[model samples]
Target: MARVALKGVRKDFGQTKVIHGVDLEVADGELVVIVGPSGCGKSTLLRMVAGLETVSAGEIAIDGRVVNQLEPKDRDIAMVFQNYALYPHMSVYDNMAYGLRNRGMAKDEIDRRVREAAKILELAALLERKPRQLSGGQRQRVAMGRAIVREPKAFLFDEPLSNLDAKLRVQMRVEIKKLQRQLGVTSLYVTHDQVEAMTLADRLVVMHAGIAEQIGTPLDLYARPASTFVGGFIGSPAMNFLPGHAENGTVEIGHGVSFALPGQAARGDVTVGIRPEHMTLNHGAGMATLPLKVDLLEPLGAETLVYGKLPDGLEVTARVHGETQVAIGSTLPFSVEPRHVHLFDKASGKRLP
Candidate 1:
């Protein structure tokens, strides 16, 4: 319902600075997810936008109006916390209607909004249940429904699905995506889970050490990371880093293994990054090949993960098809395409252009 913008946002506590000059904008009706590891200032940033935390510097605007001094209630935003924050004594219906009642809305209008939210969240029959009578997913839905009934200008979610089981988290993820799309509400979500962030976000803000490492669509960041940190953090199983010496058109690493650097001219000490999913057990003609001494194998039903070390004792991981058979302590050949290889500066850890 509103466009949210952050211009040079910075937060500090006494002498320590947590957020450092973050600039971001969320278009109206877009779902943007801010994802990072623990202690990365993601939740703190979200709290600042929700008016729960004061901004030490910089301006936060919602719907083209600066809300630097506005109270949480006056900001016209709804927040769904991680813990659900539901009352044990109130029924689901009363829980959803409590905010409206406090705002002096008519009883009939409160009922209409509450019922509409319940129907949308598939909680119509559970309206009479108390918080203790519901499951974790149900409680989460109640928390979301409470936020939806308010029809606020924007929604802020702080790791709302952290408490659910894996299956429930998957189910709730689909539900949340569908709900946000149906309502067309602008939302900003914070999560430490990279997979969850990749699945739910239209655009993702990857944060590190109180700074945004990269902000782009999930595919963009996955295909080409801006730095070594973003490259290692955004993917599952993480990207493998090999210290190599950059030559005129190639980087040599680990016991004479050299990969062709196409279209790059950075020649010096560099780090070569290759994703696990891109490593293939089958070697093709004219492809770069590395011999790996397999140390471990994890057969996940759909695919197998092979963990091994290169000739120079550098660790590497490869994802192979489910039917592939491999033995520990055996030497297996792995191939990688030249284009899938990523080059980064060894000194600064920044990706090479």
Candidate 2:
């Protein structure tokens, strides 16, 4: 395993810049996930690290060695792509051994690596099966097995599980996490799904446009988002934003509700952010309360999601325990803890200090 570093990395297609000066470090044996909406350059960034794409500017280092001009095969990294680029005519065993064979390893050494990879992937029993005969998850494991056989300095995954069904995706997520830890290999994974990024990453890089908006542990990003884009993108049932003004140590949200600033003092127009899960039906006298008109209720067995609007017509969402009983069209009181409320500058959409 080795540390991966990107210093002011960038990519451009003619005059169009896709990756704009991203600097990041992945510790040896760390699994870092790059997540963002499509066209945010997450995939392009991963490809640059793999040496599959040219670095338009800046440096990419693996194990402290600059690899900007190395070929994909010479970079000592293996990439498992979204399409599971397997040989259709080859059996699982051959698929995993092809890379080693191409490197001119001894036949016995190739066989040994192939068998060990198959065992690690639980594909030993399916070694004779061709790509068409394997299930989606099994084929993805075969893709991973191919990477594992190389014993590369790092592993890169590009939406490797996107082809699976929802249930299979969840199962493979656990498998990938366990496999990465067991191998202790440095890894960089890219995905558009925030849920997958949250569940799998030791750390996350949230990208927007062509820039890395934030990079931190999942909980850190969730609790203290660096900007409004991160707060809205990292959490499910996205954080609710209310247009309001901050002045005189108080934030005046619509409906005449105001919250006292608990720490830093900022005055001017601001966007207030509160996660759905942080809003509750219970409130104390000091807390700010807002009246919500319930529009719909979605019960997911384990929890229920309430969709509603405030008196000022700002839409909001609240998550509650599954046992809570509520009806549509009813008025309910909702409150958020003072510390849970986030304020962002209205003009810049950046978190306020």
Candidate with the greatest lDDT versus the true structure: 2
Clashing pairs in model 2, backbone N/Cα/C closer than 3 A: none
lDDT of the candidates, in the order given = 0.93, 0.94
Report the error of model 1 at residue 311, Å. Answer: 1.2
Angstrom error at residue 269, model 2: 0.6
TM-scores for all predictions: 0.98, 0.99
Off by over 4 Å in 2: none
Residue-level lDDT of model 1, residues 284-340, one tens digit each, is 666778898999999998999999999889999999898998999999889898889
RMSD of each: 1.0, 0.8
**Displacement of the residue 141 alpha carbon in candidate 2, Å:** 0.5
